[model samples]
Target chain A: MAGTVPLSRRNILTDRRRLVISVLGVAVSIGLILLLEGLWGGLRVQVSSYEENVGANLFVGEKGVRNFLGEVSAFDSSAVDELRRRPEVKAAWPVNTRFIVLDFHDRKQAAVLVGSVPGGMGGPWKIAEGRPVEADDEVVIDRALARQHGVGLGETFEILGRRFRVVGLSSGTRAWMLGYMFVSHDASAGLLRSPGTASFILVDSEDPAATARAVREELGLQPLSPDTVAENDRRLFAGIFGGPLNLMVIIAFAAGTLIIALAVYSMTVERLREYGIVKAMGARRGRIFRIMLGQTTALAALGFVVGFGFYLAASALITYALPQFWSHVSPAVVAGVALAAGLMGFIAAFVPARRVSRLDPASVYRG
Target chain B: MDDVAIRAERLEKVFGEGDVQVRAVRGIDLEVVRGQVALIMGPSGSGKTTLLSMLGAMLRPTSGKVELDGVDLARLPESRLPDFRATRFGFVFQDFNLLSSLSALENVQFALNLAGTTGRKSRERAEALLRGFGLGHRLSFRPEKLSGGEKQRVAISRALANEPSVILADEPTANLDSKIGHEIARLLRNAATEEGRSVVIVSHDTRLKDIADRVLWLEDGEFREINEMAVDPVCGMAVERKPETPHYQYEGQTYYFCSPEDRDEFAAEPTKFIPDRG
Candidate 1:
């Protein structure tokens, strides 16, 4: 043709179903990749909900326990009063986290129940619907989990065989893909069956390092700065999901490559004779090769766009349907997936282009 | 100007190796001059197409020299051969070999485009050629929608689009009916005489002979010209019998020569000679 676009594109477009199938194959692979990455970002955000939003500067935990991943640490809850006695401490509050399953309306959902002082230092900053934890049997739930569990204000559910009322709803309080339920120290202490124990203590001291050393030496509990706690939480999630995330990325790369390779290769085979004819007509091997690669490049690019579109739709659905579980779509993440898809397109067409290059011009005579 | 557009000296093409080796074209000596259409006719497996491929630089000769415009095609670099063929030679296949997705005008434009013609120039040149070939009304029609003769005419227009010095056609009239085939042959004849191109047609269809300037009958990897005139082995021209022509005798056979100069050259080195058989 005299046009800029090769006839390969027309041939592919002429068979509308094949073009759509090829585009969809690449789009679905890219969509899956974006979904996994978004979920990973969401996991990081929700897992560090406490340390990120908490106003305290220092945290005191068991000497050997890591940060609050699954909240599997416990210590004497009296550390709060002991830390408060220090002249450098502005205020100190003991915090507790426990993974508990709530039985509601004949269904069970897992939750991470975090308890802090009612109003002093370590509690939810924003409550969307209803009042804060006002009594021993009242709990604050993230709006996302509340919507998911169909429980809102004045709705009561059983936690640890005791009935508790959902009196408040907070936004963005999620951990480990589950909801974070906030309660008073006393109520959570009762839930843990250790009335005076706390998993950690948050201190709002201006000089966090000095206060941390003082708390560590006097109380024998390791006091960590907030940054260290947040970093530890991020690294912890990386350790937990790193292998699976790597595997998913590899699968995404392979799926995209194979889809392009198979599509281009089969098209090349189907038009092998046509390619020979072009060769005989004084077309260089590179010309024919470009036509084949051009097809794959067009397909991959279209697929990438479609995949990105799918991700946008999915992200919107996630935002609307699941408010507590946030799946972030970062620019870097999108660029990385697009680059991978482009690389797959470039590499995938190599074999088929090679086939086109090696085709003998005399083969057209065979027809 | 050089009249000889394509000249082959003992051209040969072999397929495979060892036990399965087959010689497709065996030592055929031929030449087609400008403003002339030379046709090669043979049954299947006669190496007609194989010989055409070597002559057109589409395939490498196993041994021998095929030259186009004094450039030895056998010695041409692989990278330069495509440009050489595109710029210097055109090809027409029997099946019309038009890209089915392209319109008739676009088909001619593709040939011009491959030789680096584009934009308005490409379109204008393609239009002029197709219009000249009486295909002005079918410029936008694709091959599948056109009749066999129309498709072949479009193919001929494509061959002439680049204004190549020579057109190498493989079975140019094999697919058309007798009437359409003759029309295609006449088109080829005009391409050579009116357009002043050298055309080489390889086909099994003898219907092309009425318009052919010279015809070669190929069989068993070798060929003999069907023309009554004899080709001067030294000067590479079909020499007619005349009182002014010189003659040479070798092994009880009388050879009429184009000139005394050619007669002297052949008489000195007869062992290197490749002569036409009766």
Candidate 2:
């Protein structure tokens, strides 16, 4: 008896050009899936950018406020002073935030306008250049947005028909469809025409649980930890974008499986007579199917390697071309794509295996 | 111990059904003892290949049974047929039937692998067989790279990989030139005489008669003795001397043909299509 031939590998490799084409086809689908997944990951990180990165341990919003992006959250500016007087509160900062479209240089940019008290906890956390906003008319905008529009320090942009000078540039402060712009609390209050009130009260306390209890029980406001606020914000965005992203991923997966199935099916059709010969020579159905699956698996594995390479390159190009749209490919994403590739191979095998199973070994004699 | 390697008792094979039915092979009985070479020669639709397929267990007979040694093959379950064929019978085809992707060595080794031989032993057996066939240097050559003769030789090496008790060849010389065809015929004969394996061949190539111990001529899905049949010089098919059978007078003798087309072909080139008996 002889050792088994690597039939699957050899069969696919027999036509080197076809194999390359098939791998590349599968690679494109895989790359698309990886790109979508990475973008989803970046969306998750971006949505929680303010709550995660701001120095506040807890956020005190108006009653019934559960999220930051879609929901309106506001409380009396006097709540900050009262929170500052509490023993559990280490520090309290009144911040007013709202979504506003800034029109400048013949373009409109959607942004989260944050009015943090000068030198307060909710101010620009990561200043890339210049100083944080101090004057009522000064603003700190996200660096990527400024660079995209060629806005620089000392340049003034109008928000809500009021002109404010760009004093500082912040990093990692953009969500999926909007960027963050920081200004003095009075500036946002004056620009939005809401006076003597704050959107949320940022609090850094010695015991966050104690402060949350005090704010909810005594001040009659909703007190949420930064993590809770971030999670709620993420859920809010996920609800908006999850369907489209998942549909794209599913389409990519189906495309990958189709590429693999098409390649294997054609190969099976071409070598059908040889398969009949093999059957006539006493190869069992199990053996024939193993060869088919082996061919598909080998093709998918090659495609995955090429796809990951494609993803890495595409991600770099995207980051360079559109700095705001970040794609993060984590280990979990890689593992998931690899598993999906294997599943594609498994699913692809059946189309051709069915053809082989129906083949008549007696056809070998016909030759 | 039984000396017969394969036995077919009133074996029949039919295709289609009802109005369109075709009786491909009808009530055929055959027995080939170990170390004997049996060559079945026939016209294109004469059921030679059909009978061969049944004998090799590649196709089940519509009726009766095929027995190898003392065991009836029909009694074996469908799942067991593959292993049974792999271990007991070796097949050769007109096309040489080598897997295009496999190298010569791997093609031969695949049979042994199918029969549960693996690793070093399989390699050694495949290597030895290819070497014995004078194909040592061609071990790594794919079928496309090999000449027709080399490919046929490789096919023979593959057939003998598991040292099967019977070797069944279909039109083994159909695609080969005369020189290579004779070489392949000798190989099949050697497998019978030297290795004591029963060799059954189905072919229209009259040259194969030189090596066969018994030659059976089949016509219209049934076997007919060569003495009761006349060979068509143009195509070498056995033609019964019936009233409607086409015949021509050549060199003061009557020659029979399976078709008027063959008769006309012979008439145009009588010397080119010389009857084997004449």
Candidate 3:
């Protein structure tokens, strides 16, 4: 019997063009999967950016607000003091969320408006390259939005027909698909034109979990931890868009498996005579089957390496071309895809291998 | 009595069944000893190849018995026949049947590995055999690159790689020209005479009769005549078989004694017998 590896390599490589096309199929499938996963990763990071950067222990949100980043949750500002009166709460700050159109340097773009108390846990934690927002006419913007509009410190930008000087720049504070423009608490209320209402309350506490429970019971406001809020927002985002992404991944995998199957099955049929000759030389059914499987497995392995390389090249291209369009593929994802390729190869060769096993060695003598 | 290497009794083979049935072989009895070249001569569909397959344990007879060195091949399980073929008999096909994916050396080594010789030793043995057949330069060539004669030589090397005692060839020279065909015939005859193996060739090529020790004529799945021997039984002189003259009988058997004097001497003293008789 022929050694399976050498025979498989020779057969698959006999037609180099065919092997390359099959590898390309696998690469496209895996690259699509990784792209979707990377987008999902970017979204997860975006949704929880504020809670993560605020360093807040507890968030007192409105009753029906789905999330803190994208939802409009307005309640009386008086809840701040009430929450701060609790022993576990060290400090409480009022904050609100609103979508407002901003005009800067004659260029207008819609931006998410965040109203917060400056120098408090509700505002930007640290400046990237500028001073913190101080006066009522001052605003702090994310570095991404600043770079997008070419704005810098001491530059005045209009928000909802009102102008505020850009005093500070913050990094990695952008929300999911929306960047923020932070202002003083009064300025936020002034922008909303709602006198004494805020969207949510940020709190610092000795024990956030215990305070959250107490605040929920005493004030009837859902006091959520940073991690809990981040998780809820991520779940909501997935519910709205994840279904389509998952379907795309599944379709790509199925198409890849089918291509591999057709290619391998045709290969086996073409070599059926050779298989018969080997059998006549006393190769058993299992041995012949292994030879077929060997070719499929080898193709899959080569395809996996090409697929991973494709993913890397695509990721680099995406980063270089679209600086703000984020994507990342973890090592575990690559391993999972490689394993999936191996499984696809095995399944693809099964029917053809069975055909080989049923072949009669006596057919080798036929005319 | 000659030491029998292969004995087939009433071998019968039928293909398909009912209206589509074809009786390929019909109860042909045969025996060929070691160091002898036996040729089954017939046209196509005469069951010569089928009988050869049955004798080599490649095809199970429909209703008959084939014993190789005293083991009833029909009684052996089907699963064991591959090992039997690998270790006990060698087969050469009309098409060469060398695996196209393998080189000549790989083909020969593959056969040796199946017969339980493996590693460097099996490779060396394959190279030695191919080299001995003067195919050393062509050992690395595939079937497509080699000529018809070289392909047959490679097939012959594969057949002999296992060192089996019996070689069953189906039209071994069917693909070669006349000169190459005669050269292949010489190779088969050498396998029997020089290596002391029983060689059986099924072919329509009548030129092989010159080198065959016993020619069995097959027609319509049955033997029309058999044991066309050239060796005289009484005086041990080589003579062509003729129906009349120098023929004698003892007990119930007839003999070709080569000469009238030898026949008369055998008739006068029936007890005195030569030990070296085929």
The best candidate in terms of TM-score: 2
Of the two candidates 2 and 3, the one with more favorable lDDT, higher being better, is 2
After TM-score superposition, the amount by which residue A199's alpha carbon in candidate 2 deviates from its true location, in angstroms, is: 1.2
State the displacement of the C-alpha of residue B103, model 1, in Å, after optimal TM-score superposition.
Answer: 2.6
Model 1 quality (TM-score): 0.86
Task: Give candidate 3 regions above 4 Å deviation.
Answer: A1-5, A63-72, A85-91, A98-113, A122-195, A322-324, B1-9, B48-61, B65-78, B115-118, B194-196, B226-278
Sorting all predicted structures by lDDT, with the top scorer first, yields 2, 1, 3
State the lDDT of candidate 1 residue by residue for B1-278, as single tens digits. 56798899998889999999999898989888989988777656778778877887889999999988899989989988889877888888878888877889988888888889887888899999889878999999978999989998998888888888899898888767768877888888998998899999887565677788888878779985444555566654445444566867777866667678889988887655754432
**What's the distance in Å from true for residue A282, model 3?**
1.7
Q: Per-residue lDDT for A284-349 in model 3, tens only? A: 666666777777777777777877777778878865565455675667877777788888788877
Please give the DockQ score of every candidate, comma-separated: 0.33, 0.74, 0.21
Where in model 1 is the C-alpha error above 4 Å?
A1-5, A77-90, A207-220, A315-325, B225-278
Give interface RMSD, per candidate.
2.1, 1.7, 2.9
Worst 10 residues of 3 chain B by lDDT: B231-240
lDDT (tens digit, per residue) of candidate 2 on B1-278? 77988999998999999999999998988899999999998777889888988888888888989999778987788888998889999998898999999999999888888999988888999999999999999999999999999999999998998989999998899778879999999999999999999999998787888999998988789987676667777766556766678999988989999789889988887877764634
TM-scores, all candidates, are 0.86, 0.96, 0.79
Candidate 2 lDDT over A1-367, as tens digits, reads 1256788888998999999999999999999999999999999999899999998899999999998887877767898889899898889998888987767588888889899889888887799999898898899999999988899999997888788899899999988668899989998889878898988998999999999998999999999988999999988888889999999999999999999999999999999999999898888988888988999999999999999999999999998889889898789889999999999999999999999999999899886
User: What TM-score describes the B chain of model 2?
Assistant: 0.89
- DockQ leaderboard ranking: 2, 1, 3
